[model samples]
Every structure is written in structure tokens, then in C-alpha cells.
Target: MSARARERPGQHDVAHPAWTLVMSVAASSLSFIDGSILNVALPAIRADTGAGAAEVQWVVNAYTLPLAALILLGGALGDHQGRRRWLVIGTVLFGIASLVCALAGSLQTLLAGRALQGVGAALLLPNSLALLNGAYSGEARGQAVGTWAAAGAISAAIAPLAGGWLVQQFGWPSIFYVNIPFVGVAIVIALTRVEEVSDPGSARLDLGGAALATLGLGAATYGLTLWSQTFALSTLAGGAIAAGLALLVAFGLYERRLGDKAMVPLSLFGNRCFTSLNLMTFLLYGAFGGAMLLIPFTLIEAGGYSPVEAGLALLPLSILIGGASRMMGKLAEKIGPRWPLTIGPIIVGIGLALASRLAESQSYWTHAFPAILVMSTGMALAVAPLTSTVLASVSRHQTGMASGLNSALSRLGGLIIVALLGAVLVAQGDALLRPFAMALRMMGVVAALGGVAAFFGLSGNWRHADSGTETV
Candidate 1:
């Protein structure tokens, strides 16, 4: 280990933990707000720019693909360099990308900007958490994380509503412009108040692995998006998909060779519980990503809801998940994660099924509200336990890597589903309802399968699992 790598976590303290927490939350919110807000603004973006379904899908996936593929590398970069330095750099880059997006007049320009935003978010998200972990210890660390989670939940709840209002009032470009001030403030605070911290010993940059993963995911997403647009797999699409799979396989082999030094230590997957939990994460989150995008679009286009009203429709999900996740987490500690994990996704499936039955003429209170309430309750039950169990499943030293991997999988799930929704994305007004319903029903099945995976794949007594080693 180098001399700098030998410096203990405690030696690098922030001037105040609160400032560190504030900077972390503010920086992280850029991605969260951007994501939630863009769903509401997509309709306006398409209307203004005359973008087709494929182009709109590119807008969303362009950001998500890079974020999902490069997130692990981003975390490693922070460890190699300084978290604070990279956090500020990420903020500046995201702000500039937002400007480019806001000023974009063409589909091509907008996509280029969105892709840059994803790169910036990849750097910002993991480093914010790493910075928080480095700045505090023990009880204070837990408190800070809880505060950060709560703040994130609040910001997520507000983003759609706020973004919807902005979109309705000023246009879709205004939504991107809103990010400028927040990023500006976060950049200033990160530079002035946050302390620099890094672990050179653990910071191994697997550039080849990162490059392969990015190319693989990008190619696969492009293939899927093309298939969705054409409803047929052309030779080009098939070739892209095949090449993506091959590259992904190569990525796995390469990581396996790198062992502990790999960006994603493949040994983590040797734990059956960890592997199973991640598979469940992908299925559940993929369903969620599809629902979130389709719900607002359907409401605005088919159900005659304005942008702001469509945003309000999702408030139940945000509020319930935010308010109830801690209670669910505590419950999991007592009874174990098995039951919550099993039942939660099942409930979400039921909710999606209910949502599929919604008609344009149905009242929001009677149809839409009930479905969202059920889905929110299910997510509230699952989200906390799933996260805590993922952490507890690994040894203390691997927790950061494990969490980053899990986060990346979740985003990857969303990215895949969005890429496959060209049909739904293209439909408008009454024509959208049929494809939208079909998509939700299919996602409901995927969510249910996630529940099944949890039930069969996880140990009954997971709390007592040997955390020092991978549980076979």
C-alpha cells in the first residue's frame, strides 16, 4: 500500500458532517430529479422537437446506458482519486450538460447532451455515498445515511410535480435549465466544505472491463430499441445483440481473471443469496421502470391529464415508499427478509394488474389512485429489506462494491425495459391505451417472478448468515 492509502478513514474528517451530508444530498439529487422530471417532460419534448418514438427512447436510454455501465468504474475512480474532487467535477460537467440539453434544438444534439449527463451522473452518484461513508463513522454514519435517504425520497417526490409545472408553464427545456442552480450550489459546497478522501490500495481502475461493459450495454440497448421500433429483428439488430452478448461474456471472463482487483469482483456472485437477490432486483426494477414511464404518458395522452396532474398521480408511490421503508426494514430484521421479499413483489404485480384495467373514462380516485397505493405499499415493503440485506449479505469490506453493483443492476433493469418500449412510446391519445395495458400486464408477470425468485433462492435465516464469507 502507498503512504496515502495507509491513511485511515477516521483521519479524513469533514469540517462538519452536516455540510458533507448536504453536499452529498444536493449532488445526488441532480440525477434523481433529472430522471423523474424527464418522464413528465418527454411528451412536451416530443411535441416540440417532432421526435419519433425511437428518438425519444434514445433520449432516456442514452443517459441510463452510460450510467449503468460506468457506475462501478466511477466508484473506483473516486477511490483512486479524491471523492470531493470528482464530486465537484461531476457537478460541473452535469451543469454544462444540462445547458447543452436546454439549448438543444435537434434530436441529435439533445441525445449527445443526455449522454454527457449520464457520464456525469455515473461519477456523481457513487462518489457521493463514498464521501458520506468516509466522513462519518458508526452511529453518526447510519444517521447521515438515513437523512440522505429521506432527503432523496423528498426530492424524488417533488421533482415530477415541479418539473411538470415547469414543463407546462415554460416548456420542456425549462426542466433541464432548473438543474443549473442546484448544480451550481452543490459544486460550490463540495469544493469549499467537503474533505478529500481516497483509498489507493483498494482503488484499481479496470479500464478494459469498463470499456467492454459500456460497449456491450450500449450495443444491446440499441438493438432492443431498433427491434421495438420495427417489431422485427433485422440483421443489424441481431448482429448488435449477438456482439453485445459476446462482449458481456468477455467482460465476465476478464473480471474473473482480475479477481479481487476487478471493478466488479465476480466472487460476490458465488454467494447464492447475493446472486438470487440481484436477479430479483433486475426483474422487479425492470417492471418498475416500464410502469413509471408508461403511467405518466398514458395519463397525459389518453386520460386527459395535464402534466402537473400526471405528476400528482404518482405522489402516493413516493409518499408511501418514503414514509414506510424504515418500518419495513425494521420488520425484516425481526422476521427475516424472505417473507417481505416474497410478498412485496407479488403485491406490486397485483397493483400493475389493476393499473392495466384502467380506462380513459374511469375516475382517478377510483381507478388510478387505488392501483398506485397498492404498488407503493409493495415497494415500501421490499425496498428497505432488499437494500439492507444486500449490505448484510457481504462482508464489511465488500459492502461498498456490493451496493454499487446492486445500484447499477437496478438502473440497468430500467434501461432495458425502456429500450423495449418503442411501441408504447410511439402511440398517442386513445391509440396508446392498448399497448400500454399490454406492457403493464407483461411487467406484472415479471414482478411476480421476482417474488418467486426471492422465495426459493434466499435462505430462511438470512440474518444469521455468515457475513465474513460468501454463503454457498
Candidate 2:
């Protein structure tokens, strides 16, 4: 091994961890920006392609299902093959996928391209995080995670504004083409700066487990998404959901049989802290996703705001989250994650409760801005510490899978909740005001419960940044 490559955990042996941070952040932005921007492009896509609602939904779902389904396997692949290697490969594939999306002649072609992009994203997200976990240690790792979170927030925040401008000036295809430059930058950085790392213990690929996971998650996600469109249980949706559940059960059993050789080491869930952390992730992210979906529609459809205005309403939130995340990471480093994790979600709940007050004819300053500030502040407090705790809960060697599972939970939470909440939207129909309020309040309840989980479940010492290597 090279001298720098031999550096032990908790040591900043690399000449510039900053470069690693930059590369990872850049790599991650490729997905975050693309995901966020596409929402804005959807109307344009519909206009250009004359696609139906189902096709548009497919355009979005095609990307998300694969991303959520394959992320764990992607992490396992990274751990077994090599993080930097996969990063490079994923970046190239993402660029190619973006190019395909840009040039897509029809809805079906676009959906195919989007699915390919999701595959690239699945490979990129967890490994980017794992690279950070392996590169930084102690307080620095917390800061790096904070920065990574901030970069993601900023990328997501910028997407709407940039996508709108690009779509207006050039075309909807510009959104996909926009990713090309970012992908190029990410690839160059990865090849030049990021170091390769892999777990020898992860040499074996659990192909059966992977296939089962992909099929299960894909079926469940499709069923859930379809369920929203038709509030009643259609035969196809019901069968898909049932089949998905069964396959997932089989996947779990298969993984258990594999023991340590499993793609997702079931033993990781055996750690109380890890389990609690993921449970918290699922609840909080689900709530976050559901509430966010309602907010933009409420503003645009109910409050009579323009689409651009509705998009800008969230600008402050991104800034708050990006700004406050690093400071909160430092706080978690100083005091431990217990208070921040517990208190942060409670505050988020409170903010969401306030958001429930939003209605037609309300001023943006009075109604939306205040809620955004409070919720973003609370979110900023929680995000970094949550990431740190998840990483700290597992051993260094397993960081990729740990990060992958956490990442997958986050995506899955959003996917499932969005689908479920769509039913409420459909049921309410023209009278969306009441449903919107209920969604916000429901999210608030979920957030508060996450705080409860953190308070009772996360051990105090491990919540601290200096917890060392106890492996929970």
C-alpha cells in the first residue's frame, strides 16, 4: 500500500481530505440536482411529448424505483469492487444516461433513460457517503458529513431555478443536458483526487439476494405509486403489492441464510443504535417527503401563486439547512447527538404543526416563510448528527453497506409516503385545503415521534462524536 493509503482510522493521513469532500459532494450533486430539476421539467415534458399522466408518472417512477431498490446492492458492489472505481463508472454511466434522456424522442425512450440514470444514482449515492466515512474521522468526519449535506441541499435548491430558466430559454431537454457538465467535472475530480477503497471481506456478490431485493422493492414501489392513482385496490396493484411483500420476505430469509456473506449483513440490524437510527430515518424522511409534496401544490393551486413563486418559496429553507447543518454537526461533535437528535425532530414537528396553519389567501411572509425557517432550522440540527450516528453505529469496514442501508431507507421512506399521501389528495379532490392541513399535521406527528425514538433509543455515548470504535 502507498504511504497515505495505509493511514489508520481517525487519522487524516491524506494530504487533502478537502479534495475528497469536494469530489464526493460533486458526485452526489449529479443525482440531487437531476432529481430536483426533473420535477420542474415534467410540465415541459408533458407539453412536448403529449404524454398522459401515467406516462409522466412513469417518467419519474422509473428513476426512483431502481434507485431505491438497488442502492444497497450498489453499496455492496462498491464495498466489494472499489468505491472510487464505482464512482468513476457510475459517473460515466450517469452522463451517458443524461445524454440519452436529452435526446429521447418519446416518452418510453425518456423513461428508459431515466431508469438508467437511477441505476447510475444507485451506484453513486452510498459510495459517496462511504468514501467520506472512510476518509474522515472524529470531529472532521462530522464536519465533512455536514458539508456533504449542505452541498446536497444547495444542489436541490438550485435545481428549480436553474431548470426553469433552462427550460424556458432552451428547452426541456436542457435539463438533462445540464447534467453533462456536472458529470464531467465529477468524473475528472474522482479520477484525479479520490482514492480507491474496498472491503476484501465483501468479495462475494450475493446475486440471489440482489435479484430478490430488486424485484421486491420494484414491485412494492410500482404498486404503491399505482395505488395513489386509483384510490381503490385494483387487481394489478393488489397483486403487485402482495407479490412484492412475499419477495421481500424471501429476500430477508435468503440474506439470513447467507450469514456474513449476505449483501446486506443482517447483523447490522442487530445493533440497537443502527436499528434505531434507521427507524428514525424512515419516519422523519417519510414525513418530510409527504409534507413537501403538499406544500408546493397548496401554494400554487390554492394560494394563487405562480409556479416560479411556489418554487422560490422553498429557497430560504435550502439556505437554512445548508447553513445550519455544519454548525449543528459541530454541536453534535461537542455535546453528542442525543440532545440534537431528540430536540431537533421535536422542533421540526413544531414547525410542521405551524405549517398546518397555511391556507388560501395567506401571505407568503406570514404563512410560508416562518414555517420554512423553523422547519429548516430543526432539519439542519438533525441531519448531520443523524448521519454521524449512523456511521458511528457500524464498524469502519462496513461503512459502505451501513451508508447504503441508511440511504435506501431515506429514499424508500419518501417513495412510500408520496404514494400513500396521494390517496388523501385524490380523496379530497377540489377540497384540498383540509387534506393539506391534515398532511402537515400528520407529518408533524411523525417528526415528534422520531424525536421520541431518538431520545429513548440512541445511546448517549455513541451519539457523541468522540465515541471511538465500539461498533455499538
Candidate 3:
């Protein structure tokens, strides 16, 4: 090891720690940005390939569906194979997949490339957290997690604009091509600066648990996705949902019967702190994703902004939230994740409370911008500590699973919320133009629900951030 690599996590590690932090943050952000980026590009792709809404969703879902499904495996792989190794492997594959996506001539080919990209993302996502956990300790760990959260939020902010510009300038394929350079850089830095850490012992890879979890989430999420787009009750989807639930229940029961390393360490759930923290994160992140989806529609439909214009309008929100997340991490050390976690959704509610009043003539600067900014701040405050707590609340052995679960559940929450919101929208009448008053009322209800979840799932027994490491 280099002299700098010898430095312990909390101590003055050379600039190596900084490099690790940046690369990890950037790598994770790449996955998140991809999640939302293609959302904007869908229309261009649809136009280019003459695809419908359902088919276009495959382009997006091909990435996200698997990312959500197989994320836990990513964490397990990182722990078993060494975080750095899988990180490099995933990054390189992601780049290759992106190149294939860029060159795709038809919708089927594009979707194939997207599925490959998803596989790569699934591998990369959880390992990002595990790598960071191995790297930073104590206050530095807190800061590193904060950086990871901030990067994700910033990516959330920029994805639409960047995607829009790329699509406008060079069509939708450019969006896929754009990933090449970033992944290339990530692979190089991750290999050079990050050290290897792995479980050399016989750490059993619970393929059974992974299979069940994947099927469960896949069925449930896909059913929800279909419901979001089509408001009618789907018997097939409903059946899938039931089957998925059964598999998950079976997975849990199966684990209890095992002595070797189970896929999901059931013992981790015994930690009330960890469970509650993750539950809160799931709801809050749902609200965040729902808001991200709804606000842009509200902007273009009700606020009378062009798509690009609406995307630009959201810029303030991204800036405030990304900046606020880092600061909140510092504050979390003193106050703990619970208070901020509780406060964040409430603030988001307040922002949406204002947003609910949006009128066709509502001033963008006066109404839309402030609402998003406050909402962004609320989300920013909640995420970093929420993530850190979820990880900290679990035992070191299960930290990979804990981190993966938090990330996965948060994505799942978004899927569920968007489906629910779609139901609300569809029930209101399938109209492009939602009058300001009606939009306000709908958002108010959603915000209210998120606030309730925050208060109940995350409040009261908030942990003290300074409480050091204790096995759950």
C-alpha cells in the first residue's frame, strides 16, 4: 500500500480519500442520473423509432427495473468480491452498454442495450455505498455519505437539462453516448486510487434470497408501473403483485431455516433504529421522486413553461438541495437523522402547500421556483443523514445489505408513489392541462401523506449521530 493508503479512514489520509469520495459519488450519481435522464429523452426516442408510451417505458424500465431488482446483489457482490473489483467491472460494462445503446438502430436493439446497462447499474449501485463505508470513518464517513447524497441530488437536478440539450443537439442516442467518457474516467480513478477490501472467508452468497427478492420487487414494481400509466385495475398485474409478495415471504421464511449466510441477514431487522430509518427513507424518497415527476408536468402544463424552460426553472431546487444536504450531514452529527428526517418531509409539505396553489398565470419566480426550492431544501436535509443512519444502525457484517436495502427501497418508494399519483391524476380526468387549483389540492394530499410517514416512521427516537459505532 502507498503511504497515503495506509492512513486510517478518520485520520489524515492523503488526497487518496478525496479521490475515493469523488469517484464513488460520481459513479453513484451516474446511475441515478441515468434513471431520470432517459425520462426526458423518451419522447425523442419515441419520435425517432416510432414507439408508443408503453414501448418507450421499456427504454427507461430496462435500466431501472433491474437496478431496483438486483441492487441487493450488488452489495453482496462488493463484499464478497472486493468493492473495487466489482466497481471497475460494473463501470466498464456500463460504458459498453451505453455505447451499444447509442448505436442502436431500432427500439428492440435500444431496449437490449438498456437491459445490459441495467445489469451494469445493478452491480454498481450498492457497491458505491459499501466502498464509501469502507473508506471513511467517524466524521469523515459522515462527510463522505453527505457527498454521495449531494451528488445524487445534483444529478437529479441536471439530468433533465443535460438530457434535453443532448437530445436537441444530437438526438436521443447522444444521451447514451454521453455515458462513455464519465464511465471511462470512473473506471480509471477507481482502479488507481481505491484499495481492495473483500471478505476472503467463505461468505456464502445466498442466491435463493437474491432470486426471491428480485422476483418480489420485480413483480411488485412492474405491476405498480403499469398501474401508473394505465389507471385500470390489471388482473395480470395484480396477480403478479400477489405472487411477488408470496416469493418475498417465502424468502424470509427460507432464511430463518438456514444456518449459512442468508442473502438478507434477518437479524438486521431486529434493529428498530435501522428499520425505522429505512422506512422513512422509502417514503421520503418516494415523495421526492413523485415531486420530481409531478412538478415538471405542473410547470409545463399549468405554469405554461416549455419543457426546456420548466427544466431550467427547477435548477434552483437542485442547487439548494445539493448544497443543503452536505450542511445537514454536519448538523446530523449533532442532532441525528431523525429530526432532520422528520423535518424534511414537513418542509416539503410546506413547499407543496404553496405549490398546490399554482395557477396558469401563477408567476414562475413567485410561485413555482420558491415551492421547488423549499421542497428541494427539505429533501436535501432528509437524505444524507437518512442514508447514514440506515447504514449505521446495522451491524458491520450486514452494512452492505443495509446500504443496499436503503438505496433499493428508496427507488421502490418512488415507483410506488408515482403509481399512486398517477391514479390520482387519472381519476381527475386524462387532461394535459391541470388547472392550478386542482393541481394544488392533489399535491397537498400527497405531501400530507409523506409528512405523516415521516412523523410516524422516523420521529421520536431519533438516534444521536455522535453515539459512535455499536453493533445492533
Candidate 4:
């Protein structure tokens, strides 16, 4: 790629800015749509495959664990290698994995495919965002990120509705098959339109840090998922958790020792704003992820709703976020991210708390719609700004790593919550309601804490200056 393309593709003609956005959105939609669709399809999958609650949770976590673990390395590799190259490669891998999933005849085969999908997602997501970062700057960057978020939200909105119908009409495998054509389109656009960009002086690959991170997160996730299933701190679960924690601590120490050479540069945490924003990301996204999984399951299993109805219940969230996030992103560019970041998660907390009142007898318009509407409004306010702020927290060269870390944290939050949902998952019919409500309320408090983090951690006028570092 030309130097101009690497530094500022928006200013040159190597690729149209609009096409770059399209390619990024299309590539990201693979992950976003897969997640939303799978939530709707989970019940069908469990029934068809005779999966217990534990195995069901594994179906989701199998994808999330690896995505969370290796995403930082993916970002680092993109910086050291080439962003566009990895983007295409990831797309192809994801497509193949989707095919494998579509053809899977057993739980183990399905899990292997899901794990591959996670690996592909890990490779693609950060680079997609980094491509935009390399192409745009300042207000335009915020708008582009907003557009990207909005497009992904729109895709997510459509996925469940479409996936529910497919699952209901054809089978769960149809959901996996849907990804193939989308992946093909994304690959073509990425290869033809997106310019390759990388930092020439980027550090060599941190294989040790990557290994430690993968093992630590995988072990922790395994322990937690097992604990949820067994509902006991058995020796196996306890040992795995203990070992995982120790490995994570060692991973942190190793990264710190490696300095800038680590897959995760510990120095990024030195920026108070960056640190606080990511903490908020973890808390808020955890709540959102848990809610996403539970709400549909509750509707299907407890409330006697069909998959289609359950999917429809979340339509408000997708529409509101898709419609409003771009405007919110621009608003944050002007006023700074502090207030949006603070207020959004608090509103989400309120919405989740309200949702905990859900009952089987309650009407969707009266109970579910109201809660979803409120949560949607809050996420619309927060999502775009949270992403833009994280990117702004670091220099241009670190955009890939920064995006990866934020994305990883979001997935990690979801992975942990899903792992902890074993008790809820095992409950049947009306019994599911109580535990589900408790989880929602707990998640609400977590979301509220995220709001508090932003309020205290970021200055009111904080923004990224021309130097590519935050200022107030």
C-alpha cells in the first residue's frame, strides 16, 4: 500500500471512504449477526441436539472465549503485518467455519466450528475498526465509527427476526448457512476496495503473551461454566479457577515486563481516561450481554412465546440503536464523551431493573416493549461514543490494539456472564423466571456502576487533541 493510503486513505483515491465503511460494516456484521441470531436459535439447538444447560452455555461461550482471548493479538498482528490482508483472511476462515457449523451433526463438531468462527472474528474486528481509523480523523472519525456501529446494530436487529423464522421453518442449521453469502461479499469488498495499512515499526509478535492470555481466559471460562453447571465449588472447578487466576496474574506480569512489546501494552492503562472507559465498557457490556441471552430464553421457555415473538421483542432495541447511534456519535464529538458515557449506562440500568418485573401473563406492549425501549435509548446514547473515546485515548499507531482491547473486554464481559448463568439455564418453565429476574437486577446494578465509573473517571470536556492523545 502507498504511504498516503496507509496514513490517510480518506484524502487520497486508493479506496473510497464510503466503500471502506461498507467493507468494515459488512465484515463486522458476520460476528454481530451470528451472535444475535444464535440467541434466538439456542432453544432449537438444545432441543435438536439434546444438549443440557451446560452444553448449551458452551455453544455460546465456545465462540466468545477465543474471540476475547486472541483479539489483542489479532490487533497487534494487524499492526505488524497488514490490516486488509488479515481482514480478507479472517472473512474466508469465518465463512468456512459457518459451512462446518451448518453441516455439523453433533455437539462437538458444532463447537469446533464455533471456536473457528471466534478465531476469525478475533482476527477481523479490530482491523476493521483500525481500517476506519487509518482512513478518517477527528469529527469524521467519530461519524464513521457511529455509522459502523449503527450498521452493525441494524444487522443485529434483522438477524434475530430472520434467524427465528429460519429456525422455525427450516432448522437451527439454517442460521449458520445464512452467514456464507454475507462473508463472501465482505471478502470481495475488503480485497478489492480496502487499502492495506500497517505500522512499519510495530513490535514483533508477542507469542508468549498470546499463549498466556489464551490459556488464562480459556481456563477461567471453563471453570466458571463448569461451576454454573454443577452449582458447586468442586475440586475440579476450584482448581481450574485458581489456576486460571494465577495464569492471568502471570500474564499481566509478563505483559508489564515486555512493555511495548507485549500483545497488550500495559502502558495504555496509565491513561486514567482509557482505564476508566474500559472498566465501564466491561461492566455495561456484561449487563447487556447477559440480558440479551436471558430475555429471549425467558420468552421462549417461560412465557410460552415462539421464537419469532421472542425475536420481535428485541426489535425495538435494534431499531433504536441503529437509528440514533450515529447522531449520538456526532453529538459526542461536539460535547465530548463524558456525559453520554455517564448517563447512558445509568439509563440502561433503570431499564434492566424495570425488565426484571417481566411476567408470563404480562403483555409485550405493556411490559417488554417499555423496558426494551428504555434500554435501547440508553445504548443508542452510549455505544458510539464509547467506541470513539477508546480509539481517541491512544495514538494513531495504537488504534488497532486499542480497538481490540475494547472489543475483547466487551466479549470477555459477555463470556463471564454467560458462564455464570448455569443456574438460570438449568431451570425449567416458571422456575426460570425467578432466577432470570435476579440476574437482570444484578446486571442492572452492574450497569449503574459503569455509569459511575464514567462520571468519576472522565473530565467533562475531555477530547482527543490533534496530537492523538486525550485532553480536557
Say which candidate scores most in lDDT.
Answer: 1
* TM-score-superior candidate, 3 or 4: 4
TM-score of 1: 0.95
Q: How many backbone clashes does candidate 4 have?
A: 0
Cα lDDT of candidate 3 equals 0.67
TM-score pick, better of 2 and 3: 2
lDDT of 4 by residue, 1-472 (tens): 4333363355345667788898888889999999999998998898899988888898999999889988877776787778887888888889999999999999999999999999999888878887887778888986897688778888999998998899899999999999888888888877777777886466348889888988998888889988986588989899999999999999999999989888888998887778888999999999999999989988898888888888888887899887887787778778778889999999999999989888787899988999999999888888868876887766776765776788889998999989999998988789999999999999999998998998887874344453265522
Tens-place lDDT digits, model 1, residues 169-255: 999999999888889788877777776778766786999999999999988898888899768999988998999998999999999
Ranking by TM-score: 1, 4, 2, 3
Which structure is stronger by TM-score: 1 or 2?
1
Clash pairs, candidate 1, are: none
Residues 1-472, candidate 2, lDDT per residue (tens digit)? Answer: 4322332333334437787898888889998888677765665676689865456556766787778878877776777778777877888888999999999898888989998998999888877877887889998996797678778898989887787678767888988988888788877766666677887555547789878988998888778767866567899989999999999999999999999888777998877778888888888887886666667656655666655666688778777888887788788888778889888888888889988888778888998999999899889888867865787877766665676678888877776776666544443224767777877888899988888888877765443244344422
Per-candidate local distance difference test: 0.87, 0.77, 0.67, 0.85
Question: Model 2 TM-score?
Answer: 0.85
lDDT of 3 by residue, 245-312 (tens): 88878888988777447766677667667776666666666666666665665555445655566667
Q: Which 10 residues in a row give candidate 3 its minimum summed lDDT?
A: 3-12
Q: Which residue pairs of candidate 3 clash?
A: 356-440
lDDT of 4: 0.85
